[model samples]
Target: MRGLWRAHRWTVASGALLGLSGALLAVWGNPVNTGICISCFLENAAGALGLHGNPRMQYIRPELLGFFLGSAAAAVLAREFRARARGPGLHLLGLGFLMAVGSAVFIGCPVKAMLRLAGGDLTAVAGAVGLVAGVRLGIALLGRGELGLGGPERPAPVLVPAGVVVAVAVLAGLAFVPGALIESRTGGGAQHAPAAVSLVAGLVLGAACQRTRFCITGAVRDAFLLRAAAPAAAVVAVVAAAVLVNAFTGSFSVGYYDQPGAHLQWAWSALGMGLVGLVAVIAGGCPFRQIIRAGEGDLDAATVCVGMVLGAALVQSWGLGGTTAGVPPAGRVAVLLGLAGVLGLALTRKERIA
Candidate 1:
């Protein structure tokens, strides 16, 4: 027990903080089971920026901005902000878009799925299973030297950090200036914690997550790839902490029906998260991790963030998003195509026999 504590104490702390943050954010006015959902928040930010015209889905979330700016600050202070690009290809962008689509179909990202489970939503189980399966599949392919995107290189000094500065300015304009961005007067887009509160929460989370390298899929990935106990233990800590908070906050609802932001298409939920897991593995990060890394001056991650925002917009514009009614036929088809495309990418990627 002492050895385990020595190895996993920091992870446990990070996970506890993350879990408490999610639950408290929900209690503070963010949507239940959606305190730190990257995909959903990205979609909201896209709408606010007029990337999509969904009146019911437009808001500039300060928490989202804090994720980037705060992570950037952390990276800079830690002297870890070295701008590096992945090898040639639009592959990362495509993966990012596909990741968003997958999250849309599932109605949340891996983090949110876990939060939902913590809130006692049984439906998230399918998504969790799918994520594990997808991560396992990625591990298998990686083991065989398939789908190898080459290592990062070409350390441009100011590329990504400069872009992050621009993003901060632009996003701040939209967030603070009236008429600069559209806003939803109703629905989920209208629901949020106070901007100051959310931003502070986000800043704290970003710094902590960056410092700890916390990621839902990465945790699962490390468990498989390195047989590490700390990562998995961190995840368990998240669930346990959130569960305790949910129970105390009167937010725990132990059932599948009428759950907020959930769909009845269990198989599709699994597949959607499977796609998320697969793309996250290939891209070397999940949606939240991508945002953090982008702030850290990883141009590959920045490109992926751009793709994710584009995807967030496209899902609404193209009507490819799943709903509480269930995944539309188009959403299902899109997931299928995404899976096929992933397989194609794997087969076509430059082989590096491991």
Candidate 2:
């Protein structure tokens, strides 16, 4: 299949897979306008674990575990399961933290932004622009070749099974342990597709994504920095397919106002996503890619994932995230701070001009 993908238009295949997976997820029961939001799902999972007391958003989503395990399976099957854990863990941790915070403020990741656009949310346009602008800035800095983190030394394949084991244990607990995980009494947390459907969709999407190395941030970055269209083609496919599905399925509603779990604050949306994009590019992948990398045993990616979960908890607990009313002042301030931190990191590196 991997070889076949290489022979064919792999980008289209990947994008189609993502688009279909997202549409199917929505049909299967996720909240309207939200199919497979990595950040949002993580936020919900954090709430489920009692990491946050938001009763409106609590559920031990199985999709997170499914994605990790599925990616691990793909990596192992393809012999791409190399474990590399080098570089500054604190840097990755902090970047991941900022990535999560930014996404929380925006109420979505790059994927969600795209999905929102596909669902006819014009508010996501600003966010998408911010993402592109952020990537462009990262590309400019990357040209100087100073952004490389130190490389990993040893391969820790054991982390693969360890991660899978943890995922399985969590899934089992969510399934069998009554009240072990919190449930949302109302709001977005109360909305969900069945666990089985969501998990299966996640597993399928994870395996496909891992095989293709599909990443929303990477797609945007490569499109701009490397003049690569294949990845971008895949991303476009996701949007096109999602739009078609939503339109036919009656999920498409064009407008920013009254969008599910979203606000009409265009500037905040853009700035928030810009922060997410900037940090994601610096960190080398989007939120979902980080999860897949963790499954493949990249300790840095794992660290980032943990940081994202922590960020999610912090945002909800501290009221740093926005609600349907509008963007919170705290959230906007956090975006500015996150941008400052990312800029400092980008410029402080000692890479010589090419």
- Return the top candidate by TM-score: 1
Against the reference, the lDDT scores of all candidates come to 0.85, 0.79
Q: What global local distance difference test value does model 1 have?
A: 0.85
TM agreement with the true structure for every prediction: 0.95, 0.93
- Per-candidate clashes come to 0, 0
lDDT of 1 by residue, 1-354 (tens): 457557667767887888888888888888889887889998999998889988988998888888888788898899988888854448777888999999999999888888999999998999999999998888766754636256647777785477775768578646867777888999999888887888888888888888888888888998887676766888888889999999998999999887999987899999999999988888888899998888888888888888899999999999888888999888889999999998877776565556
Candidate 1 off by > 4 Å? 1-5, 146-148, 349-354
How far off is residue 138 in model 2, in Å?
Answer: 1.2
**Candidate 2: misplaced stretches above 4 Å?**
1-8, 146-148, 157-169
User: Lowest-scoring 10 consecutive residues by lDDT in candidate 2?
Assistant: 1-10
Which residue pairs in model 2 clash with each other?
A: none
